[model samples]
Target: MLMFATNDQLLKNAIDDLGKYVDLKDLGEPRYILGIQVNHDKKEQKIKREQKITLNQRKQIDDILKTFHMEDCKAVKTPMDVSQWKQSLARATESKQATNCPDVPYQSLMGHLMYLVQGTRPDIAFATNYRLWW
Candidate 1:
């Protein structure tokens, strides 16, 4: 965590007291980090961050699976595909029709998946990234 104070004495004291043990790196005025946009409002002394994701991000993921008629997909204990995704690119590239994956929608889903992976769904990180890049 970082702390700032209007008083230089306070800032110095705080840093001197705590700086010995903490590893601090200053990346000034963050505009983007981890696919999220951060805006600092100088007048209001406030920070605002927003990341774009489909309003129905989770629903999209579920709907895609359901549309593929995977509602009855075996309820696997784990979220990631441990075995097959490594070679998914080859299959994806060779497919003649844009049936299972299309460019525009796939990109949108990839964006949503990326945001989800960064936030609440860490377990799906590898699987989603693999699926997207492939």
Candidate 2:
């Protein structure tokens, strides 16, 4: 399946002429393609690509929250504490002995965070990368 967009009537006419010798089905203007929502502003002559959170993404986040028992946690203004995080990192490095921290699903959580990073939550990229080193 081939998809294309053109505003020129000459091109449309050319395509229609070629259609006589080839099989083609025009699906018309597109609103969505490959999971990304497309919005066209004809008046402004601009197009925008929007990534909406899917139901599966919502479920993944909910499941992660439930796994960590943070389903009822309150939303915070800031997502990270830089000073506290630095202090903790310093302590971990200074202590030669390994800490007996409970095994958290860090990899799984990071996988989800990566998807968020690739999607709409790019603000969390730095924090997520920092946590990966821990």
Candidate 3:
């Protein structure tokens, strides 16, 4: 369990209180949490109002792509219009067409991608949602 408090004394007190009931080992500041890289600047963090912390999941995204065998895929720089997506989905899921993937774990792939979308990649949320629904 990770807990933070503005006051150092209060946080130490809480930790001490919890330690009595549970075996607690302070891991000291976290470097990463849940595959997201935690970037902290102590100098910059001095000012509470202007302080900023960044969380990155590039490693997780790359691992996801490699796991799904999409490492060498080309990047789509152009922004696709919503209409184009609807048209694409319509053709892909036509009533007469029989689409089946017996070998590929498509649902599993979609589920993994969905996690990425929820974490830090909202850009692919629509695509993941469509795959999950359709």
Question: Which candidate's TM-score is highest?
Answer: 3
Clashing pairs in 1: none
Least accurate 10 contiguous residues by lDDT in model 2: 47-56
Q: Give the better candidate number (2 or 3) by TM-score.
A: 3
Q: Model 3 over residues 49-134: C-alpha lDDT tens digits?
A: 44456777899889978988899998763244678788877877775232565667777788777777777777877666766665
Q: What is candidate 2's lDDT per residue for 1-101, written digit by digit as tens?
A: 43443445665887788799998877765655433345545645433342232222455567768987789999643356888678867987897323455
**Candidate 2 at residue 57, lDDT?**
41
Query: How many clashes (backbone atoms < 3 Å, residues ≥3 apart in a chain or on different chains) does model 1 have?
Result: 0
Model 3 score (lDDT) = 0.75
Q: Please identify model 2 stretches exceeding 4 Å from their true place.
A: 1-59, 74-81, 94-99
- Screening candidate 3 with a backbone cut-off below 3 angstroms (N, C-alpha, C), the clashing residue pairs are none
What's the TM-score of each model vs. the native? 0.37, 0.48, 0.74
Candidate 3, residue 15: Cα displacement in angstroms equals 1.3
Weakest 10 consecutive residues, lDDT, candidate 3?
A: 95-104
Better of 1 and 2 by lDDT: 2
Query: How much lDDT does each candidate structure score?
Result: 0.58, 0.63, 0.75
Best of the two (1, 3) by lDDT: 3
Better of 1 and 3 by TM-score: 3
